[model samples]
Target: WDFLESPGTDEVLYGGAKYGGKSWFLCVWSYLRACAFAKKHKIPKSSHPLKVGFLGRKVAKMFRETTLDTWFKTIPADGYVAKGNPTEIIIDDRVKILTGGFDNRELVNKFNSAEFAFFAVDQAEELTRDEMALLRLATFGRLVVNEKAIPGKGLLTANPRHCWLKDEFILNPIKQRKFVSALPTDNPYCTQKYIDNLIDSLKHRPKLLAAYRYGNWDVLEDAEQVIMDSWLESALNRHGEYWPFVKEYIAIDCARFGDDETVILLMNNTDIKEKIVMPYCRTTEISGRAAALSHQNNDCELVVESIGSDLGAGVVDELTELGHSVLVYTPQGKSSEPDKYYNCRAEAWSKTAKVLCSGVIDEDSNCFVALTKRGEGDNYGLDDTMRGQLCTPHYKWVRGKIVIEPKEDIKDKLGRSPDHADAYVIAVWAWPFISMPNKSGSVRHRKRQKSPMSM
Candidate 1:
């Protein structure tokens, strides 16, 4: 209340653990306040109804399934007109409850044009920052009551999520924002059985258990998420198939040393008409030189190949002797972009992060809508093991620069080496240079045209 009632417009984030009745609070509080504004203003039924906008399908469901029962069973119906048309209610002709969602443009447009005494945002963390901004704009100058102005207020409820909510409210507390981390323990109505069910269902997903069950807002996915789980899930669920093409390179992380299996990721990046496609991935104990020979025998492009540094240097030298081009991944080698990273490995991870975070490709169509030409989206073969590996590494901040978790540390957490992940990250690093006309580094000193995968 202090934050909302203070002297300026504000948003209050009621966030943290799951099943804390946070959404319930946002709904009732906004409605009750709207009622107060209407009654105080002596507003007539024909006058512009005082309203409080509710955002998200979940909130609408809550109001319909549970909240409606509370209002009718507890509060007298004579006090207000309660009608359910996909969930809208009125109390004493004073307050109008408006609900909408990202999928409903009509609801969004209504909010855009109308004024509200306040707004209620449910599962706000699921909304992008831009969507929330639009809601705030809708509240502008609409908070007048009783011939006086009150600051436009927004109450947002959310489960634990690593999104703008975490950044604005907790990581870097924005001015005038009241961010609360509410736990199940803090709510008397939140039952132990409910909490126990969540714990049981999420026992295998540690990240979720930390956020939803424990409400550890300061932790969870914030941990070194080198590559966030969201990105991996999105990528895995986004695309299904790809066709092999020219402008290909094979990157292999050799398992010559131990229990690790060597991984070969065959990628296609030949045309600017399409984002890169990684269609073929293989795991084997085959020697590096033997793998090269196999591609050679098949009359494959076999243009560029890279080997992990952990494996013996023999295969790289042998491939060179056989007149095949092979690049060796050097973790401490100079970075392509030194400003953000210390070395090639770190830069590769940075590149992977960039592609994942930026919505360069359409989710359903798997098309590269970000490009002016509008081509197919970059794709990777779906392998659950590879997906798990892709999300395994945690990032570290070294001298203010980002770097991947050390092999030792990653192995400790994963109980196995991230060979497939290294193979993929190194493959991304190899794309710009590997496809360079036969002479890989001859044009290195000269500026080259951007790879289709970039930007």
Candidate 2:
């Protein structure tokens, strides 16, 4: 609390175990700022209004329900009255707090020009680096009243996740700041019994317990990789044969020689659903794996082959003989123009990761299930495949939209060759066919629209 009130600190990161008073602290800070602005600005006590923005990713509604609702209850009934959307709050006409989701780009831009005495971001880990950078720049310049001082600072409360913020903001040399670690025990209002009960409930759920109870970023139990659990869950929920209704289906094939598993990932462009119908561990011959692919939805046309060596080429030939369209891609020579190695493979992996993180891909289905079941521990062929597909090089956008440049080094350096990695490349290659048109009517339309499968 003291550090928050202190001046000169431009950025603050409050991360720790969940059930802590982090959310409450943000509420208090915002309320105090609103009250201060009301008193100092000399606008009528009734008419003085301060605008504050709260941002989140998926649980926008949940955030409002928990934090914003709790905040209102904490304030005396006579001091403030609830108004506007439940996601937003109008406190005694002195403060207008707006809640927004990160997925809605237009809504996020609303804060770009508006000045507020305070700004808060809940679940800061969910925000993209681009979004954070935009908010930072927007909050620059003079305040609404004080033409000299910056309008207001921003507060970020989140459970630590594997993200750039861990490196850029928290560890950045320029931002001389301190991080406050809060635990469930820190909340004076909550009882020990209550905290214990909550912890006990999450004991069986390693990921949740690690994130919410223990505040450990390294603990990702269910997912073999670091992809968000929500993304994985959503994918699983949307899986079915109806997935073929999408425009394109691309399969990425990563072959395994010895203890490794040969994985095949089937992806459709429409809803971004992926199915790992074939993930065979300790497989040598490609013929058995080829038999598995034969069982997948046959309507999808295109297979992207991640060319590795002579053995990989043989597998591709076997797949081709099965009457499937295939595109063979090999790594560009180290001296090839920009970078050596397969640029397409690298781009495909990067694109796949972006889609997963953006919550665009659905993982719940035969594909994910097969991959997880086959790839376990030190023999994480499928696991490495997924990570390679999801971890792409992203550019930092200080202002406006940022374009991501592909990285060859990242593709080459990632450990192990994954059959699922091949599937990721295939999925990305087929992405354009699946993407839905923007509401704004920005692009040309493709004539063929595939039918969706039953969920």
Candidate 3:
């Protein structure tokens, strides 16, 4: 109650394992907050009754499915008169209980014009941090509300989810905002037999059981994920710039068939600025190179600080003939850090992973849809397809060296080559140009690649 009762506390989160009595606590406490004023002052004012609201993602499911049975068992039928589609309970003729749903834009908007003395939400993790901020707006403009007459506060309860709730209340906590850990064991009402049966049913699912039984947040990892969700979320939508020992390049993953599109990633260090995805035929048309010179012109017109391609079959010869500099990725080539990585690509991607996970995830960010701008303080725009490709590849250790999941496996996982993200990794690596210090305190680079076409 430190967070709810403290003068400094305006927000508090009570979350952890399921069946930790989160729903019950919210219900019972909400009743107390509603009826406390009249109980304290026996002769209550007939004029302004106290008002409290409870909300969640869906009004129907929360009220009809989950809270319906519990609400009847807790609040006496004689004390509160309840009614309606929006759901309300009038208590002792001195308080009004309002329930709201924030599952959709229209639903959340209904609350915009309304005000409440106090508010509480269940499963707060299902909503984003921005949505919670709007909920806090309930406390504003209650100048007439007597302090003892109506004390408005915000409360949230959720299962341990890998989202903003963990970011604000668990990992980095402020004194004013409290985080109380509630395990299923903490509830006396939960019988030992019930806990045993729940644990037994989840025995085969380790990650899930850990969260449900012990509330272990660390157990959440998608086995097929190459790029972490938080890392991708932050980088994709992130703003501003940092001193990054900047470098620039374009890495192309050329398409061999009519169906696939050649992907070009424009990057500054590890940060992507743009992606150019076009079929060979389309590119030739756009470059206006007719007849035999069409392919060569199309290749040269890419214009980047530097260019590298995985397809060296003809682009290396074509671009070099056009007096354009180009490098080629040799996947099986020996690694600069042979002991730590299996091949040059593995070493490069290993470095890419470090750079990607450098920052924390920002919640409720418009990053997934933002238009990608170039140069300082910008990021390449990302769509759902790009996000799926970026997050699809997972890595594993073979003989103590990091190896990216196989091409065929990744194709199966993402339904296509991770062409955009692969080219992005190469562009960011910009191999042999700059080196970042590794854990062992060594700067590494592949042995210089031999000339494919001598100047």
TM-scores for candidates 1 onward, in order? 0.47, 0.47, 0.47
Per-residue CA lDDT of model 1 for 320-339, tens digit only, reads: 56556666777667876564
User: Which of the two, 2 or 3, has more lDDT?
Assistant: 3
lDDT for each of the candidates?
0.57, 0.51, 0.58
Candidate 1 overall lDDT versus native = 0.57
Instruction: Give candidate 1's TM-score.
Output: 0.47
Writing each residue's lDDT as its tens digit, candidate 3 over 198-306 gives 5553443456557766766665656224566567666645544333233334566666556655666654444444566767444333222211222432322222221
lDDT of 2 by residue, 77-139 (tens): 676666654355666675666665665666667757765555677767757788787677656
Better of 1 and 3 by TM-score: 1
lDDT of 2: 0.51
Tell how far residue 337 is off in model 3, in angstroms: 52
Model 3 ranges with Cα > 4 A deviation = 38-50, 55-59, 104-107, 140-143, 146-151, 221-455
Candidates, ranked, lDDT: 3, 1, 2
